[model samples]
Target: MSLRIRNLQSFLRPINRRFPQAVWSSRVVTSIRYNSSTPNNNSSRRPNSGEEGSNKKDTKDSDLPATNDEHNELLEKYNPDKSSRVGTPKGAIPAIDHDLASLLKKPKYEYNPENNTNEVTYEFPPPKSPKQLKVEKIREKSKPKSRFKKIAPSLIAAGLASWGIFTYSYLTSKTDPDKDGETGLLRPDKFLPYVISFKHQIDDDHYLIELTRKNRHKKLINNETLFNGKTMWSIEIKQPDINIVRNYTPLPLYVAGTDPVTKEPHLRLVSESEEQGKFIIIVKKYKQGEFSRWITGLNLLHPVEVRGPIVEHKFPGHPLDKFYIKRPQLANLLSKIKPDPEYPEKLPKPENYVYYGAGTGILPLLQLIYSPNPPKGFIEAYLSIHSESNLLDQFKTLNYFAEKIGRVKFHYFIGEKGEHLSSKDILKPTLPNFTGLSDIKLSEEQYREKLLAEKREEVKRQIANGGISNEGKKSITHEEEENHTIPKLDVSKFKPDNAFQQFNIFKKRKTTPDPSFAFVCGPEGYMADVSGKSDLNNLEMVDNGPIGGKLKEKGWTLQNIKRLQ
Candidate 1:
């Protein structure tokens, strides 16, 4: 009986436990909610009900937080040094532990939120002590210095190399040549030819020294035979005053303007020297020419080598440049003055005209007037001036011009100032045939009367105004314009009929038929004589000795004379 009762008890207990389980299962079904609806405790506990299964799993996972290795790792990473835990926003996670953030805090900096973005950021830190800051700054600066240090050795090496190259070039340039050192190019190691020198009175007003170089082959040294007639020598001038040196030393004289008829070489630049290894040089010793004095006083043998023959003018055409013209008259005149294909052209009909010359200043102007292509509407004219009587007598060329172009009216003043000629006497109508002469003689009585009368009239006028006191007499004399009609005092006397008989005198004058140019040389006086009186037009100044008078209106060029070993 006891065994049967025990069996019933066991059976009942099993049945009871099964009944609770069944009840719990039933309750879960009735209270269950779908995943699409709000979660509730009455959800089905069965695995088939997705909502209940997921909820149960979540609850279980929440309860086993200690067992989650991932949570432990997260907590380990978030643990900061000494800060409190901070609450995070819902659905957001904290990136760092509060303790770690405390370590980054500094004085003068507070975390503040940016108004626009609502983002928190740290403010600028406080400035450190000056000494500590300076130390840090120095370290920062040293970084750049370290970088440059690497290249310092290389820079030093490069500098040394460049210095070595310069030293080598300087040394090489000073060495002597192998041959003909006497006549070779001037160099440090070679000696220039020594020339004998002596001084002589050139005139009452001046003294100059003549130089003669050591024996050398003239043909080899002077390649151009232009100086066959004149001497190939140099002169050293000596004057005391520096002012005289400045006035007399014509260091550089250049040419300007084009040859009216021939568009030949047009410009020249010249320099003069009285030293060794040089060609002809013209040095003018004006009474007040300062540079002349300086040049003349130089010890010619004291290694005083001069440089010159610089060409100021060049051919208009070139590969690298377009010629630019400056003077308008020259441009216009040059365009019209084309070269004539024929050897000679018939002379134009003679027209009466008068000319005035002022000392030697009228030279270049005269050349232009006598030029074949003289400015349009030019007429035969008279010339007058004090005679250009000198030892050299370069003015003789004027006679040739007067002979060829029909005699120009001439009034000569020789020795002291003499008779003043009237324009009517010089500008008289002339025939096509005319002649020119260099010297003319008039009776002294007539010349003296004219001079005395002119002087008396001047004194009479001064006394009429109010007699000059002794002091006033020493001062400059002023003349009334009306009283001094002086009529541009005729420098030349004209015998138009006499000139007409001497026409066609230039039939034998040699001319440079080819494209040629001309240059004028000598003192200001000499230059003026040729410039104004010569047949060449557009007379330009040249730096060196002349090549030919035929190409007188062509360009003056600067040429260099080189001494080769």
Candidate 2:
């Protein structure tokens, strides 16, 4: 058996060489010895059993202990425990032991067999230090806050409040329709205070008052100069705990003369009683007008608040150009026509004007007539008064001054005391330039026959023109129908009578046709009658209130007729 064991050792020598660093222990060698000592059970299969036993013996021998030196060498070569050494190859990732990782993840438990209980325990991470906690807080605080989150609410609230305030103010504000929606609040800074320096009673109801402003306040009126009959100032008075305002065109208190230093003509304010800083206003008292009554009762040095040089009419250069050219449809038509050489490009000064005034209405007309360097025009004025004494002397004085600059003709309709002359009778014959009642009567009969003949000719022309067969002709006829359809005033209502006849006579008398502007300021009825019947086809009309409505109805454009009031 010893020999057999030696042979088996020899045969395993080659196998051991293949695994030179295989680990071995004393228990493994003992197991190999026991396996070699065991007997085979099979007798008939002796050879097969012997061979199998031998292979088992060899395998057991391979695990047997070698010499001490060889064992120590094997321990060094292939270590089972390498706790103190780096287990990874150089520049290579270390292999992870999943078993160790699972052991660490499992909870450790202490078994108490006596009580049949298990006490579970786990290790927790260490608590943070104060310094580490502070650092973490700082990192959190360093993050930027959202701007929308901080300010969005405040912005939304302010926007809503602003919109509400604007909406309320717009709804409550007072506006003027005639002034293209201008607010009623005039600039308070422009108001000037004056004192009534003098007052003279010209008649029972007519008074001439003089106002004076301090020399320091002269700058207030510096830019207050305006074109005659185009602008006026408002006088506001406070008395009897009531406010009254009236508008008046200030008269020239002084003659305009050339400035010696600048060579520019300067208007020197005239003071009738040698008073400095004086201006005059001719006011006619009315029975029911609070402002007029207050003015009549005003004592010397009474305080008055004045505002504006409010412009009623703005003079657009070249009247016909502005008047006709502003209408786009009309302008397009006019563009097709060749420009006329005789048509004046501009009238440096007006050529002709007709003025009609009664009582207080004459003040504006008088201002225009007496203006220094007045516009070059044939001015015809018709003045109607309660009595000859009321404005006869004033008229004479006006005529004397007016003749110096231009031709002026004045017709006075003076009535007996308590006998009020009808405005129609006063304005009718004068506007037509009839010298007496006989001329007016004769012209009326001829004017009726002439109007009838013109109507018949107009109908005949319409029929001859094929009525409305042509499309272009149809359009023209439609427009003509529209124009002719305008409501005409009753002949009795206007009493046109001889007005057109007088207009023809005036036109024939003039050497050449001149551009004209007509001004009528009197009773509403009188202005309506004169404006409706007057045949100054080339003239423009200006008045106050709706007195020009009749003219507007008779195909006169609102642009050609301005209502100041």
Candidate 3:
């Protein structure tokens, strides 16, 4: 009560007039308090209106004495350990040592204005924590790189491009005295030079042209071994003007003599000494063939680009091929067979190996049969033609030999002669079921994919568990097969062109899957008639697609038929 009276006296003294002490002290009763200097304590009571302005009657709180009780309470509230109030100073906050420069607050230093000198005394940039220092370094790195560093990649790329262009020009244009403008031997990877030697225009559509080495001094590497084989191969002659290429099968024939009757060239093949790198190719120029048009128009005695004795197909070589049967040996075999000009007693039991060729497609077939040691067993050749051709001379020569030898027979189906190649007697007897090799291979591939799936999961598990130390980069070497769905075949890519006709010859019979020995080559129409048409893979190489066509209808698979490109 005395403290409340004292406090009210101190408060009311600041404002002039005294408020009733009862109103000042008791908040609930809406009153205050006061202590007077005189022992007349009734001085705290409200005065009547006439005595209101009397200054002497008022008491000041300064006159009131201080109590030990109030002073003791002040000391306790400030001392955190002994403080009556809650949460005045919670758990102790860390403080900086006085000796070190702290970043928390600014230091005080000033200059005397009269003196033209600074009185400040402190080092700049307070020391940072380890984490702050690391963060600062990262920020510096994240900033954009200097001019040189920013453009370094582009500069490097330009330099490399310039170097490549210069290198290619220098290497290609640089001439060697012995090389004859070529760096090395003929190859598929590079287009090498060859000079056009001789060309014979058999007709407006047919051309028999010859290509020989540009560098005659630099002999080719065993060209005989490269060209002669059971495999029917061709070379790609590139038309540089249009940047196009066409594959042509070369014949082993040459001008033997000029015909005394008409002064035309007489053709003859074979001479052991003439086997180096000399051969001629027969080209038929179709109307829309840019490659053919450009090739035939090429200047004589000038160099043209050519590549490869590209192996188109490799047939299984006969066991006797190792013996090297010479022309004399072939002659002896021909002399042994009794000559029968006509089809005698069931046509020599029909040759096990059969060939169906149309137009110039017969060139490769001729190359195979005319080779020193031909395929074992009789070969039945069925040649199909749409018109009468000058090929008759060569045909007569081949058929004459075929009749003398009797091991091979030539069957011609000339459209002009009222004989069609699609004769049932020709195709129905053959066309075997292709042993389902394609299906079997697909099954094996699917099984391999299942194994690969398991392997991929194992690899993922290892990666999650941090097996780098255990594997030592084994995953990089592991073949990662694509998890792609089996793509549908693009039938349009292999579909016959608008120019070519498609023939359909179908026969069905119960067949045991047999190894296919039949090789068919012709225009789209004829091919459609024989085994189905073949397609090219993504690489543009001939792909024996899932065998479907006449052959497929007759239960033939890829294994049973080989289509020549």
Per-residue CA lDDT of candidate 1, range 460-552, in tens?
998786778878762334665345655764423522222222233212224312111222333344333333232223456423334222122
Which one wins on lDDT?
3
Winner of 2 and 3 under TM-score: 3
The TM-score, computed over Cα atoms with residue i paired to residue i, of candidate 2 is 0.38
| lDDT by candidate, in order shown | 0.34, 0.49, 0.57
TM-score-based ranking: 3, 2, 1
The best candidate in terms of TM-score:
3
**Which residue window of length 10 is worst by lDDT in model 3?**
499-508
Off by over 4 Å in 2: 1-190, 216-240, 254-277, 319-349, 392-395, 417-515, 528-559, 562-565
Cα miss at 239, model 2 (Å)? 5.0
User: If scored against the real structure, what TM-score would every candidate get?
Assistant: 0.23, 0.38, 0.47
> Model 2 over residues 141-214: C-alpha lDDT tens digits?
99887999679899999999999987875665545222112222223335455668667676788877766653
